[model samples]
Target: MGKPTGFIEYLREAPTEREPGDRIRDWNEFHNPMPEERLRTQAARCMDCGIPFCHTGMLVSGMASGCPINNLIPEWNDLVYRGLWREALDRLHKTNNFPEFTGRVCPAPCEGSCVLGINNPPVTIKNIEYSIIEKGWEEGWITPKPPAHRTGKKVAIVGSGPAGLAAADQLNRAGHWVTVFERADRPGGLLMYGIPNMKLDKEKIVRRRLDLLEAEGIEFICNTEIGKDLPAEALLKDYDAVLLCTGATKPRDLPIEGRNLNGIHFAMEFLTGNTRAVLDKQPGKDYISAAGKDVVIIGGGDTGTDCVGTSIRHGCKSLVQLEIMPKPPQERAANNPWPEWPKVYKMDYGQEEAAAMFGADPRTYLTTTTKFEGDENGNVKAIHITQVEWTKNDNGQFIPQPIPGTEKVLPAQLVLLAMGFLGPEQPLLDSLGIERDSRSNIKAAHGQFTTSIPGVFAAGDCRRGQSLIVWAINEGRGAARECDRYLMGSTDLP
Candidate 1:
C-alpha cells in the first residue's frame, strides 16, 4: 500500500465535462483532464485490497464487474501515487493495448466491484487509467516496438477492430508475420465507422493506433471484403492460420406497421453516414438532417444514447428515447449486494446532455412503438406507441403486455432504430464453413477460441455477441496465444 491511511485521507475526483450548452454546438469530445496533482490524490485513494477483485474479470450476477483485460491496477495506482507516472504507463500497457479507448468508452465495472465501494465511493480507476495513457502519448513514451526477429510464420486477421488489432500485436511480437484485412476504406472495423468521432475521434485516436500497428510490422489491407472482394479460399490458402475478428454487425429490426417509410432508417445507416460526412469534412446536401425535426429513437441502449447525442448536435427540435423495459430502481434492491455491477439507474453521457438541455431525461420506460405514421409523400410523420407492462405467461417467460387505453401518437419526422445487434452477419461465416452457437454467434467456446475448422479461430463480438471493448482485447490476446500454439506446437504469449 502506498499509504496506510490513503483511502481515508483522499476523496474521489473525476475530470469535469464541458458545459452542456457549449458542447452541444459541436461533435467534439467534451471532457477536460484533471490537474496532475489532483489525479495523484485520486490515485492515493486506492485501498489496494488483498483480494483485488477489480482485476478478476469474472462474471458476477450475470454482468462483468471487473477489468476483463486483467490490468495491473494496484501496481499502477501505487506508481501514480508516488509520481512515477512513466512507470505507471508502462504497467498499464503490459495488459491493455489501448487504455485511451477503454478509458473513455468503458462503463468502469471495476469501480462497482471495488472493495472500498462496499462502504465509500470506489477509487477513480477509470480516470487514473485515462490520464496515464494520455500522459504517455504527450510525453512520447508510446511508440511502436516491433519484434526484434521474425519466426517466418504468417498469420491473417480478418477484421481490423479492437480484437483483430490486439491479436495482430501479440502474434507479431511473438515473431510471427501478421496482416489485417478490413472491408472499410480505413482499418478500424467498427471503431472506424460504426462509432461516432465524438466518442472516439477517428482521425486522432483510431488512425493513430492504426499507424502504430502498421509501424510494428503488421500489414493492413483496407477496402477488401473476404467473401466478396477477396475470396475466403485465398486467405486459407495463403496464411498458416486465420483469425476472424469480424464484429457483430447484423442489427435486430422491429417489423411493424409502416416499416418501409422514407424517414425510418437503421441506426447504422444514420450513424455511419454521419461519421462519413464528418470524415469527408462536410455534411453536404445529401446528409440526413435532424435539424428542426422531432426525432424518436427506439431501443434504449448505448446505440440509443449515441443517437440522442448525435441528434442534439444536429439541432433536433425535440427528441424522445423509448425503452421496452421498465426503468431500473434508483438504488440497489434487497436481493442486490455490493461487489457486483449495480442494476440501479444512472444517466449515461447522452442522457445527461439531454436532461441538461430539455429539463428532463429523454428516456421513456415501459414503452413500445406499434407503428410508424407517415405523411402523404411517404416520409415519416409521427409514431403510434403503446405502454406495456411485464407479465408472466404460463411458461414463466416475462413478456410485454400492451395496455389497451395507453395508445398514443407523437410527432416524429425521423426515426432511428437503435435495437442491438443480433449476431455476426451469416454470409461470411457461412462462406468460411464455420459452425455457429445456438445464439447464432460463432461457435468458439470461452477461453478456447478455436472454431470448428482446423487452424481457424474467432474472437470479439462475432464470437461472444455484442460486448465491451475490454473483453474484445482479452479475447484477442487469448486467441493469439491459441493460434501461436497451433502453429509452433508450443507458444509464449499472454
Candidate 2:
C-alpha cells in the first residue's frame, strides 16, 4: 500500500459535477475532472485489507457484488497514489479493455463490496480508473500497438457493442485478423446510440477508441446486418470462426389500447434518434422531440433517467417519470448487507437535472399506467395511472395489485416507454439455427461461450440478457479466450 494509514487519515472525496441547471442546456458530460493531487489522495484511501473483495467479481443475491471485470483495484490505487500514472494505466489495461466506458457508465459494484465500506466510505475506484485512462490518452501513452506476427486466422465478430469490441481487441492482440460487423449506421451498438451524449461524449470518447482499434488492424464494417444485409451462411463460409456479441435489444412493449397512438415511442427509439440528431448536428425526420411538450417517461431505470435528461435539454414544458416499483430505502436495508449492491435511493444525473429545473424529483414510484388516452388526431394526450401495492399471489409470488379509487389522469404530449429489453432480437438467431435457452437468450454456457453450433460462440447481453457494461467486457474477454482455444487447440488470452 502506498500509504498504510491513509484510509484512516483521509475522508472519501469525489469529483464535483456540473450544476444541473447549467448543464441541462447542452449535451455535454456533466462530471468535472478531479485534479491529480486530489485523485492521488483519494486513491491513497485504499485500506490494506488482506482479502480485496472489491475485485472478487462474484454475484451475491443475483446481483454483482464486486467488479465484474475484476479490475486490479488495489494495485492501480497504489500506483496512482505513488504518482506512477503510466504504470497505473498499464495495470488498468491489463484487466479492462475499455475502462473509459465502464468508468463512466458502469454502476460500481466494486465499491459496494469494498471491505472499508462496511463502516466507512468506499474508495473512489471508478473515478481513479477514469482519471488513469484519460491521463494515458492526454500523455499519448496510449497508441496503436499492432501484433508482432499474424496467426493467419480470420475471426468474424457480430455487433460492435462493448462485448464485441472487447472480444475483437483480445482476438486481434492474439495475432488473429478480426472484423467487426455493425447493423447501425455507425459502430458501438449500445454506446453509440442507446446511451445519450450527456453521459458519454460519443465522438471524443467512443469514436476515439474505435479509430485506434482500426489503426491497430481491426476492421469495422458498419451499416451492415448479419442475416440480412449479409447472409449468415456467408459469414460462416468466409470467416474461420464467428462470435455473436449482438446485444439484447428487443424492447418490452406496453400493448395497451393507445400504444399505436402518435407521440408515443419506445425509449430506444427516442434516445437513438436524439443521439443521431446530436451527432449529425441537426434533427432528422425520425427525431422525436419533447420541446414545449409535457413528457411522461415510464419505467424507472437508467433508460428512463436518460430520457428525462434528454427531454430537459429539449426544453420540455413538464416532466414526469413513473416507476412501478416502490421507492428504495435511503440507506441499505437489512437484507442488503455489505458486498451486496445497496438497494438505496440516490438521484442519478437525470433526476438531479429534473429537480434543478422542475424543483422536485420527477419520479413517481409505486405507480403503473393503465392506458394511454389519445386525442382526436390519434396523438396521446394523457396517461391513466393508478397506485399499486405488492402482495403475495396464489403461487406466493409477489405481484403488483392496483388499489381501488387510485386512478388519475396526467397530461402528456410525449410518452417514452423506458421499460427494459426482454432479450436479443430473434431473427439472427433463427436464421443461424442457433439454440436458445428458456429465457430466449442464446444457449451458451457462461465460462465456455461456445454455442450449439461449432465454430460459433455467443457472449454479452445476447447470452446473459440485459446486464451492466462491465459484465459484457468480462464475457467478451472470456469468449475470446475460448474462441482462440477452439481455433488453435490452445489458449493464451486472459
Candidate 3:
C-alpha cells in the first residue's frame, strides 16, 4: 500500500460530469477528466484490507458483489497513488482485457463490496480505472505485441462482442491463429451498435482496440453471419477448434393488441438505427424519429434508459418510462448486508438528463402497459396502463395482480419496447445441432465451457444468459484456457 493511513486522511471524490441540459444537445461523452493529483488522492482511499473482497468476483444473493473480471483493484490503486502509471496499466491488464470499456459503462460492483464502504463512501474505483487506461493511451504505451511464434493451430469464434474479442485475444496470445466472425458491418457486436455514442465513443475507443487486434495477427470478418451467410459446417471443417460467443439477442415481446402498429418498435431497432445515423452522418429509412413526439418506453432497464437518452437527443416532446417492479428503497435495506449487492434506487445518466429537462424523473414504477392503442392507418397513438400489486398467491408464488380501477390511458405517438432478452436466437445453435439448457441457452459447463460436441465450445451470453460486459470477458478468457488445453493437451493461458 502506498499510504496505510491514506483512507483515513482523504475523502472520496469522482470526476465531474457535464450539466445535463448542456450535454443532451450533443452526442459526445459527458464526463470531464479529473486532475491527476485528485485522482491519486482518490486512489489513496483504497484501504488495502487484509482480505480484500473487491476482487472476489462472486455472486452474493444472486447479484454481483464485486468486480466480475476480478480486477487487481488494490495493486493498481497503490500504483496510481505512487505516480507509477505504466505499472498500474500492467496490473489492470493482468485480469481485465478492456479496462476502458468496463470503466465507462459497467455498473461498478467492486465499489459495492469495498471495505471502506461499510460507513463512508467507497473509493472512486471506476474513475481511477478509466484514468489509468486513458493515460496509458496518451503516453503511447499501449500498443500491439504479437505472439513470438505460431503453434500451427487455428480457432474460429462466432460473434465480435466483448466475449469474442477477449477469447480471440487470449487465443492469439497463446500462438494460435484466431478469426472472429461478426454479422454486423462492424466488429463490435453490441459495443458498436447496441450502445449509443455518448456512453462509448466508437472511433476513439472501440476501433482503436480492433486495429491493435488486427496488428496482433487476429482476423475479423465483418458482415458475415455464421448460420445464414456462412454455414456452421464451414468453421468445423476449416478451423482446428470453434468457440461460440454469439450473444443472446432474442428480445422479449409484449404480445398484446396493436403490437403490429407502425409506431411501435423494439428498443434495439430504434437504438441501432440512431447509432448508424450518427456514425454515418446520414439518415436512412430504418431511422425512427422521435422529434416532436410523445414517447412511451416500456421496461425500465438500461435499454429503456438508453431509449430515453436517445429520444431526448432527437428532441422528443415528452417521455415516460414504465416498470412493473416496485421502486427500490432509496437506501440499503436491513437485510442487505455490507458485502451483498445493495438493491437501492439509482438515477442513471438518462434518467438524470430527463429529470433536468422535464423537471421530474421519467420512471413510473409498479405500472405495466396492458395494451397499445392505435389511431387510423395503424399508427400507435396511446397506451393503456394499469397499476399492479405483487402478492403471494395461494400456492406461495409471487404474482402481479392488477389493482381494480387503476387503468389509465397515456398519449404516446411512439412506443418503444425495451424489455430484456429471453435467450440466444436458436438458428445458429439448431443448425449446428447443439444442445441447450431449459432456458434455451447453449448447454456448456461454467468453468469448462465445452459443448456437447468435441472440439466445439461456447461462452458468454450464448452459454449463460444476458449478462454484463465484465462477465463476458471473464467467461471468454476462461473458455480460451479450456480450449487451448484441449487442443495441445496442455496450456499456458490463464
Candidate 4:
C-alpha cells in the first residue's frame, strides 16, 4: 500500500460534470476532467483492506458486486497515487482491453463493493480509471503493437461490439488473424449506435479505438450480415474458428391496444436512428422527432433515461418516463448488505438534464401503461396508465396489481418503449444450428465458452443476456483464452 493511512486521512471526491442546463444545448461529453493531483488524492482513498472485494468480481444477490474483468484496482490505484501514470496505464491494460469504454459507461460495480463504501463514500475509481487511460493516450504511451509472431490461424468474430472487440484484441495479440463482421454501416455495433453521442463520441472515442485495432492488423467488415449477406455456413468453412458475440438486441415490446400506431417506436430504433443522424450531420426524414411533442417513455433503465435526454435535446413539449417498478430506497435496504450492489435511487446524466429543463425527475414510478390512444391518422396521441401495487400471486411471486380508480391518460404525440432486451435475435443462431438456453441466449458454458458445435464459441450478451459492458469484456477475454487454448493446445492469455 502506497499510503497505509491514506483512506483514514482523505475523503472521497468525484469528478465534476458539465452543468445540465449548459450541456443539453449540444451533444458532447458532460464530465469535466479532474486535476491530476486531485485524481491522485482520490486514488489514495483506496483502503489497505486485506481482502479487496472491489476486484473480487463475484455475484452477490444476483448482481455484479465488483470489477467483472478483475481489474488490478489496488495496483493501479497505488501506482496512480505514487504518480506512476504510465505504469498505472500498463497495469490497467493488463486486464481491460478497453478501459475507455468501461470507464465511461460501466455502472462501477467495483465502487459498490468498495471497502471504504461500507461506512463512508467510495473511492472515485471510475473517474481515476478514465483519467489513467486518457493520460496514456495523451502521453503517446498507447499505440499499435502488432503481434511479433503469426500463428497462421484465421478467426472470424461476428459483431464488433465490446465483447467481440475484446476477443479480437486478445486473439490478435495471441498472433491469430482476426476479422470482425458488423452489420451496421460502421464497426462498434452497440457503442456506435445504442449509446448517445454525448455519453460516448463515436467519431472521437469509438472510431479512434477501431482505427487502432485495424492498425494492429485486425480487419473489420461493415454492412455485412453473416446470415443474410453471407451464409453462416461459410464462416465455419472459411475460418479456422468462429466466435459469436452478437448482442441481445431484440427489444421487449408492449403488446397493448394501438401498438400498431405510428410514432410508437422501440428504444433502439429511436437511439440508433438518432446516432446515425448525428454521425451523418443531418436527421433523415424517418427520424423520430420529439420536437414540440409531449413524449411518453415506457419502462426505465439506461435506455429509458437515454430517451429522456434525447427527447429533451429535441425540445419536447413535455416528458414523462413510466416505470412499472416502485422507486428504490435512498440507501441500502435491510437485505442489501456490504459488497452487494446497493439498490438505491440516484439521478443519472439524462434525468439531471431532464430535471434542469422540466423542473422534475421525469420518471413516474409504479405506473403501468394500459393502452396507446391514437388519432385518425393512426399516430399515437395519448397513453392510458394506472397505478400499481406489488401483490403476491398464487405462486408466491410478487406481481404488479393495477389499483382501482387510478386510471389516467397522459397526452403524448410521441411514445418510446425503452423496456430492456429479451434475448439475441435467433435467426443467426438458427442458421448456424447453435443451441440456445431457455432464455434464448446461446447455450455455452461460462468458462469454456464452447457451444455444442466444435470450433464455434459464444460470449457476451449473446451468451449471458443483456448485461453491463464490463461483464461482456470479461466473457470476451475468457472466450478468447479458451479459443486460443483450443487453437494452440495451450494458452498464455490471462
The global C-alpha lDDT for each of the candidates, from Candidate 1 onward, is 0.89, 0.95, 0.93, 0.94
TM-score of each: 0.98, 0.99, 0.99, 0.99
Per-residue lDDT over 158-225 for candidate 3, one digit per residue giving the tens place of the 0 to 100 score:
99999999999999999999999999888998888899999998988899999999999999999999
lDDT of 2 at 225: 93
**Model 2: per-residue lDDT, tens digit, 167-250?**
999999999999999999999989999999989999999999999999999999999999999999999999999999999999
Write out the backbone clash pairs for model 4.
Answer: none
TM-score of 2: 0.99
Return the candidate ranking by lDDT, descending: 2, 4, 3, 1
Task: Report the C-alpha lDDT of model 4 over 45-111, residue by residue, as the tens digit.
Answer: 8888889999999999899999999999999999999999999999999999999898899999999
Worst 10 residues of 1 by lDDT: 282-291
How many clashing residue pairs are found in candidate 3?
0
Model 1: lDDT of residue 194: 75
Which ten residues in a row are the worst by lDDT in model 3?
277-286
User: How well does model 4 score by local distance difference test?
Assistant: 0.94
